[model samples]
Target: MKNVITISRQYGSGGREIGKKLADKLGIPFYDNELINLAAKESGFCASVFENAENKATNSLLYSIAMGMNAYGNQELGFTNLSLDDRIYLAQSDVIRKVAQKGPCVIVGRCADYVLKDTPGVINVFIWADIDFRIKRVMESDNLTEAKVIERIQKIDKGRANYYNYHSSEKWGRAENYHLSLRSDFIGIDSCADCIKSYIEYANNK
Candidate 1:
């Protein structure tokens, strides 16, 4: 495939698994937590730092004001004045851009769709599942009690939503923000990938 596909998904939606399978089928590399390792190498920071800061927003208004200077051709403030989280995000953004430039691949999460928004031949997809389906999936996958599973799912989804909303202009998991939105409960993960492939083909042909 010549085009790249980016998958943004909910916590228990099997997004990573689906992306891997799709990429394997297409003979392309699959990126999920692998993005963290790449960023660590490129940014010279430990991978755990990116893991901890994943999907979190910086609360430093002053830093944003300072970084805003970079937007207006003023690089005078410099990164020393920014917070650790902002610095990490800047590094992560650089890594993401570089990865996209390398080749067509399947990228999972990390606001990749937004990072590569202007890149040619890209398809953005969002995966979501019904509450019952997600809860059951998490329970089976994690071997957690029902109560624990529900709590974990809610908290994780909230974190992802908050992170996406904070980082991007559009709201997370909203239909308008993604080129295609699929419910894993009805479609199944494999079929979801098939549907995405078909959509990509149609998009390219049209």
Candidate 2:
């Protein structure tokens, strides 16, 4: 059976790098922003639209009603009538499902665990780190001041939490929602990847 790994992560925790390295070690495809491009192409929406709506929650009641109508109405007409966020999400969800169906792969962020919840051979992992570690990582990587990095981290994390909580039945960043939750700062990024690979092997054997 294929081993589809979904990694939900905190910003600057090196989750994306870990997922890429893990996929390389496992010889499987890695998907992160690739899903956004695919969703744009598949849905005929601009790539910018997907990027803008990525990990964002739409809380407008009117928008939700419009989205509901679009979901039930004619495809082409309804799609154009739907909100940009709804269109991007539906498109990404479809692409995520198709990607999982293709074979074993590592998918990062974008609520992929929720997208593939019912799919077989899926292992959901969440990666986080100490706030200090995350802030330092982002500051160095993005060439930003500590204050700027902290602000960015908080905003992005809040967006991720809101998006995950709004779209999924489970709470964001909660240990219970994932099969394995790791503190990347404790074990390091490469070690975290190795741990996930080992977990996948163990899970596959079971």
Candidate 3:
């Protein structure tokens, strides 16, 4: 099977841009929000349902306390008994693995790194940037005030972290969990993509 590249990113880190670039350079496919449509098709759920669930972080206090590291989600229920959100999560996860199996591709966000944790030939990457850099970047694209951008960044990043932590056994964006980490603001997004490409070449050839 072809190698899969999964990217976990901080909000406004330009991770999607980098992943797209890397996929283009490597002549592979890239998945971001497209996962929703795919998963919807796969699970027979509407895209809006997944989108809504994806945006909201879990509020399971008991699960968080039991997990003891980060705020996690409740898992006391089995698949048949799971809430709609939980079922959507599982459906999306299955789509992630299914796509990965189809061929080499760059997948951004949606806790794909965790979803494919056990899959071989999968390279998990984390993209992050300084808060200031991230804030400025968001402002450029979003037309939001600095303060608003900051709030958005915090909210989105927190949601991502909580979602991933709740669903996965590992911490989101933890350096050790990723095979590669890129500081996109420091090296520039394009260079970050190039760096991953170089790493991939090495990984495949070595």
Candidates' lDDT values, in order?
0.78, 0.84, 0.83
Instruction: For candidate 2, give the lDDT of residue 93.
Output: 88
Lowest-sum lDDT 10-residue window in model 3? 66-75
Model 1, 99-197: lDDT tens digits are: 778887899988888878888878899999888988888899999999998877776777677556555657888898789999988979999888888
Evaluated against the true structure, the overall lDDT of model 1 is 0.78
Q: Write the per-residue lDDT of candidate 2 for residues 22-131, one digit (tens) a residue.
A: 99999999998888899889988888878856444434344345445435254456565555566677789899999999999999998899989999899999999999
Candidate 3: tens digits of C-alpha lDDT, residues 1-206: 33699999998999989999999999998998888899999989988888855446734454354334422234434454466766788889889999998989999888888889889999999999999999998999989999999888877887778778777866888899899998999989999999998888889888
Clashing pairs in 2: none
Q: Once superposed on the true structure, which residue ranges of model 1 sit more than 4 Å away at CA? A: 55-77
- The candidate scoring highest on TM-score is 3
Cα RMSDs, all models: 3.4, 3.1, 3.5
Q: TM-score winner between 2 and 3, please give it.
A: 3
Q: Model 2 misses residue 168 by how many Å?
A: 1.1
Per TM-score, what order, best first?
3, 2, 1
- TM-scores vs. true structure, each candidate: 0.87, 0.89, 0.89
